[model samples]
Target: MGKENSSVLPVLQWLNRVVSEPHYLLHFLTFFSYFVIRCSATHILAPHLIHHLLQREIQTLLVFAVLALIKGVREETWEAFIADALFLAKICIFVLAFTMDRRLAIWYVLVFLVMHMLTQQPPFQGLGTSSKLTPLQLESLLTEGNTTRLWLVEFCASYSSGCIRSSQQFPELSITYSSKILSFGIVDLGLFPNAAEKFGISLSGCMGQLPTYILFDNATEVARFPELDFETTFFHPTVTKGLLSRHFDLDRSLLEYFNVK
Candidate 1:
């Protein structure tokens, strides 16, 4: 009789009992804390650090917990799905933006999308206007002669011979002289002669090549000038074709430059 009674108890009864238990609350809180920690660590601490951690067993456990939470939410509500999808989409967009050259329209779209997505909430309604400038506004600005064409140049200047020669004994990477050029005219102004000066690199000639060389060197130096010529070209629709073509070539150059191994 006892065995029969246990077997006959409804599944809902077991579920209710499980939910009412104190341990269930403890487990929920623990899982919640872990999720918060992972989210904060990934966004605030170091993205690469969290990226590495996510490749471990702990990340698997966290994913499981997140899945469990989604399941517990019960209803297949639109708001829930939309919220989750947006979160995932925002992450993917930003990741792609950071990984690729910032000059791409796709990168700008990602940034705007993330900003607009966030501003769909209260107290930040004007972000929609601030995050984007309309085509008409850009056109009027261009017609008013408020724009300038600039040239950028970059070159490898010098290297330490000792660092290069000691590849077997005390191997070190050689430092090369790099420069930039910025010209308002069609041709490089050549005003900046010293490659080592603070702004020696010309934006007109070599700014487009900076990322290619930096990637070739396996370095992150180009990130220092995030708002260089790319930002200036952001509002100019006419230059889109040229910019994209140059970017494609730059991608090829990056691979070729890095093949130095």
Candidate 2:
């Protein structure tokens, strides 16, 4: 449950921001006003059409829910299953309300649209954004006082085959593993001699062993991979992801996601 909470921290933060702001309350009021006006106009213009459309929308929502549930079952993860269940429940509630009262259905959909718009440009955009860190930035991160996060630092040369391969994998994995517990970054030895000096690796001498892995926990260096065969370690995303997962006590499900053998 602690791990789950860590993963969901960004979501909780987002909710807090939304509910805490006066602008969001104004947005809600605007949506409510529009929904009331629209529903009133509809009832005055065509009361008979409301019942007819409600049945059709309910039928469509039901069919979509069934298909989505089937797909979620095939996914075979607790998160997916729970998400599908919640989606079905939401649709059922909407359908029931639409059947009983048309005005409530208008309010529901308009409120949902307003919330979706609110979330389009989230405040915590950096939670999932990944970029290379220079020596100065990396040092700042270490001293930022947030000791709970995990940092994966890669020291690699520009021309190394292993570095090239890992570069392609890191961006995708950074997105896949975006959470409170994990971050990914790269340091190019070719670019920064000063940064390489801290790790005791000269830029000119890094050809034979081009890529090195270092893991940090609580702003302290916890693990450093020894110079290993590039083909078996640095070149493979699964091996890297799996090693980090095991070291940090992450879920085994990530192994399957990263295709770790």
Candidate 3:
């Protein structure tokens, strides 16, 4: 039992590290191996079976083409279908690469950027910056210490996607509410291990999970949100506002501020 546990522990730790940080080389090698295996499968398959499969797929395409022509498909409809087909093809490529070789998929995706870059533009320009808080600063703002009525502090890391998303929202949130009513602070866990340790937050546990939001009402924790919640809610202003509003008695005026009816 001890031997088995010891063997599994190292593998688990290795997996934890690999998942916690991005490794392009690891992804590339994995994908390349899968790609080679897939290529080898073609050589192993009987030529007769491959030919039969190709014929069947061609027939299916012809049937779809005929049906489209009979339906009087407009130019726009054809364009839309073509766009969807291209998107599906791209997804198939990404899936193949992601499953076997992720590094290639990440690079190959640049091919589609031309289309997206030509079509889309960013919606928001970002509002401003969130305040930075150190251990002493944070301790001073706790419930027992002199602090505002409501405070929200984000324990974040530079590498965390959720943290970056939350940071984008922080500027807007702080700007709308102002520091008097509701304030925002950020403590980078990587830079300040003591802060994370002092707050009983495990850095290893926080590797892939970050942007832990702790809402304090004069130092007493009113509400806390974990990484999973941020993953789902960070991108949606309405959903995020709803969560905060319910727990923190956030002003209804924020709805107007965000143009959410």
**Winner of 1 and 2 under lDDT:** 2
Q: Report RMSD (Å) for each prediction in the order shown.
A: 25.2, 14.1, 17.0
Best by lDDT: 2
Candidate ranking (TM-score, best to worst): 3, 2, 1
Regions of candidate 2 where Cα sits further than 4 Å from its true position: 1-129, 202-208, 227-261
- lDDT for each residue of candidate 3 in 1-261, tens digit (9 for 90 to 100): 999998688457545544443342244344355456557746765887556645644564565566555443532222233333434445555655444446766765764464344432111234454577786877776644445566777787654434543445555566656544466777788788777766655566334446567777677777766434546443433214345555555574344335633
Please give the range of 10 consecutive residues that has the lowest summed lDDT in model 3: 74-83
Model 2 is weakest, by summed lDDT over 10 consecutive residues, at: 119-128
- What would the per-residue lDDT of candidate 2 be over residues 1-261, giving only the tens digit for each residue? 999998688467645665775434444454355446446756564566666756765686678778777965564333234334445645654664576468876776776666545532211123234557888887788767773266777677655534543444445456776555567777777788677768755354333445666767666887765444555343433225445455444453344335633
Error of 1 at 185 (Å): 99
Per-residue lDDT over 5-69 for candidate 1, one digit per residue giving the tens place of the 0 to 100 score: 77556344434543564432333343344445445656564666555555543544466557546
Looking at model 1, residue 228 earns an lDDT score of 47
- Output the lDDT of residue 111, model 1: 48
